[model samples]
Target: MKAIVKSARGKGAELQRVPVPDCGPQEVLIQVKATSICGTDVHIYEWDEWSQSRVNPPYIFGHEFSGIVVEKGNLVQNVEIGDHVSAETHIVCGHCPQCMTGNAHICQNTEIIGVDRDGCFAEYVVLPSENLWKNDPSLPWDEASVQEPMGNAVHTVLAGDVVGKTVAIIGCGPIGLMAAAVAKAAGASRVFAFDLNDYRLELARKMGATDIINSLNADPLHIVKQETGGAGVDVVCEMSGHPAAMNQGFKMVTNGGRISILSLPVRPVEIDVTNDIVFKGITVQGITGRRMFQTWQQTAGLLQSGQVDVKQMITHHFPLEEFDKGFQLMLEGNCGKVILHP
Candidate 1:
């Protein structure tokens, strides 16, 4: 089987013929149909500092995918061969205190697929049955492949009540765009999206953002406050890892409002603890991956119910052999979710 692997430490991945993996008793072997490139994948491809510290080379790395079960282990009963599925990338330690308390999304020991182990960037990949999400047959493979990231957007938007509230998303990346759509579907009275990229800001508008701002020139805080009658937005979804955007999100959020942060900053960002958080009486929540099965259910429901349409966000598709081109588009920020067919 041919798989894309980061066989060496520096930069770039290679398409090489590797032996097909054998499914373990608790795992399922999926024949990957469609997979999507993630920002994490780019870090690994570029061999960035984060990847150097975490990713071990000679490993197949990709997590977002839609595939069919070609075979399953003897112990896998909930799913069977021929089931169409996608998976939760984080393989949690079921015995951890967080898992024991139903917070498995933040389990003490989590092994992410494509990062900690070999993942679905090949003709076939293996995954634990517990992580399998049986995708609706009607859902397009390209759409199903992106449900993993979409789960992130859903979790962030649903973290607090958004119904009839004014909300601002401080980023217009794919997930941020999804959040804009989800916020609208969840009944947010006004959705303000901010980003430097004009393409993404336009995409955010299509995703239901009432106003899209290029934060490079526009004063997001001023516009948001003026629109909300100087009270500021009721909720702020901080999806941009930019330090300035992080600080701006805190300022745009109304006092006693909620701020859910999903971006990971590359460097330490300074925050005014007194004015930005403590004195404002605001609630700040750090969001990570989806909330185990709960967020997955919501993600699937949003897509199936047509509340959030991710099709438009899928801007490019390429065969596994053209992976480099797809990555280039991602780096240029000229496209949204780029799907890879294997």
Candidate 2:
């Protein structure tokens, strides 16, 4: 079998021939059909600080994928051969306190597929049967491969009720664009999207943003304020993770409004906690991965109902041999979801 391997430590990945892995008793073997490149994949490919700290070399490294069940271990019961599926990339310890409390997404001991172990950038990959999400046969493989990230967008936008309320998303990356669409589908009266890239801002508009603002020259807070009659947005989804964008989101959120942040800043960011949070009586929440099972269910519903269109989000497709081109497009930040056929 051929797989994209993180062959060295410093930078980039290589497609190399490797022996096919055998499924564990509790795991199932998936015949990889389509997989998508994530921002995390780019970080690993570039050997960024996060990847430096977390990923070790000689590992297969992709998590977002749509595949077919080619084989299953003896203990795997519900999932069987021939099931079309994608998976929850975060594998958690079922015994953790968070898991017991129905917050398994934050389990103390969580192993991410692509980061912690061998991943799906191969002809075949193995995953715990429990993590497999059966996809609707009608869903395109490219779109199905991205459900994991789409779940991130869903969890962020639906953290609070946005129906009939104004909402502002602080980035127009793939996840941010999806959040804008989710906000609109969930009935946000006005969805304002902010990003420095005009290409992505235009994509956000197509994703259902009521307005788009390029934060490079214009003030997002000012535009949002003027559009909302100075009250600010009732909800803000912070997806940029940049210090300035974080501050902008804090400023654009109305007093007593909700702010759900899914982005991770590269370094420490200073904030006026007293003025930006305490005095404003704001309710701020930190978002991680999708809620286990629950968010997945909602994601499936949204896709099946056609409330959110992710097909428009996919900009490029490549075979496993052309992974470099996909990575280059992602590095340039000119593309949305990029899928790979193994």
Candidate 3:
């Protein structure tokens, strides 16, 4: 099997021949058809502080994938062989308190497939049956490969009721673009997007954002306030992990409005509680990964119904052998989601 391996810390990923993993009783073997590069992959390539602390050496990289189930373990009854599928990357313990309360997405004991274990950038990959999602045959493999990130957008945008409300997304990355589409499809009266990159902001406009702010040139808070007649927005989806953007997102929310944060800030960030939340009387919600099956179902329905079009988000594609090039493009921020075929 040909796969990309991160064999050591601070080393570039190398394409190498590796043995396909065997499936356990509760696992399923998937023949990898398509996978995509994420910002986390760039972090690993650069051997950043996050990767240094979380990822061990000699691991396969990549988690967002879509493929056909080649074999299913005896214990895997829900999914069958030859089924088209995508999966939740976060493998959770079914016995945790969170899991027992039907909040398995935030299980105290969680292991991400790409970071904590072998991932999907290979000819074959193994996944727990519980994490697999059956894809509609109508969804193309390239689009299905993006369900992992699309779920993030679904969770962020749907955190609060968006219908007939003014919504502002604080980033224009792939997930943020998806949020723009979700906001519009969810019936937002007006959707505003903010980003430093003009290219990404333009993409957000096409994704259904009624207004865009290039944060580098203009103040997002002023623009958003002006657009909403100085009342701010009804909802703020914070997708940029930058501290400035996170703080601005809180300020951009109208009184009694909701702010859903999906970005993972790498370090501690200070917030002005008095001015941003207390005085404004805002509702602040921090979102992590998807809400497991619920998010998947909503995302799948959105895709099937043409409410969220991720095809434009996939600006580049490459063969597995050109993994470096894909990672380089992501690092340069010149492309959206870049798909890789195995």
Per-candidate TM equals 0.98, 0.98, 0.97
Give me the runs in candidate 1 sitting further than 4 Å from their true place: none
lDDT of each: 0.92, 0.93, 0.91
Number of colliding residue pairs in each model? 0, 0, 0
Q: Among all windows of ten consecutive residues in candidate 2, which has the lowest summed lDDT?
A: 264-273
Q: Give the TM-score of candidate 2.
A: 0.98
Give me the displacement of residue 209 in model 1, in angstroms: 1.1
The sequence of per-residue lDDT tens digits that candidate 1 reaches over residues 1-342 is: 989999999989999999999999999999999999998899899988789999888899999999999999999998989999999999999998999999999998999999999988999999999999999888889999999999999899999999999999988888999999999999999999999999998889988999999987878888887899999999999998989999999988899999999998877899998998999999999998999899999999988899899988889999999999999998888888899999
lDDT of 1 at 90: 94
Question: In angstroms, what RMSD does candidate 3 have relative to the true structure?
Answer: 1.1
User: What lDDT is reached at residue 162 by model 1?
Assistant: 100
> How do these models rank on lDDT, best leading?
2, 1, 3
Q: Residue by residue across 157-268, what tens digits does model 3's lDDT show?
A: 9988999999999988888999999999999999999999888888898889999999999999889878889999999999888999988888889999999988877788
What clash pairs does model 2 have? none
- Model 2 lDDT at residue 63: 93
The candidate with the higher lDDT, 2 or 3, is 2
Task: Kindly report which residue pairs in candidate 1 clash with one another.
Answer: none
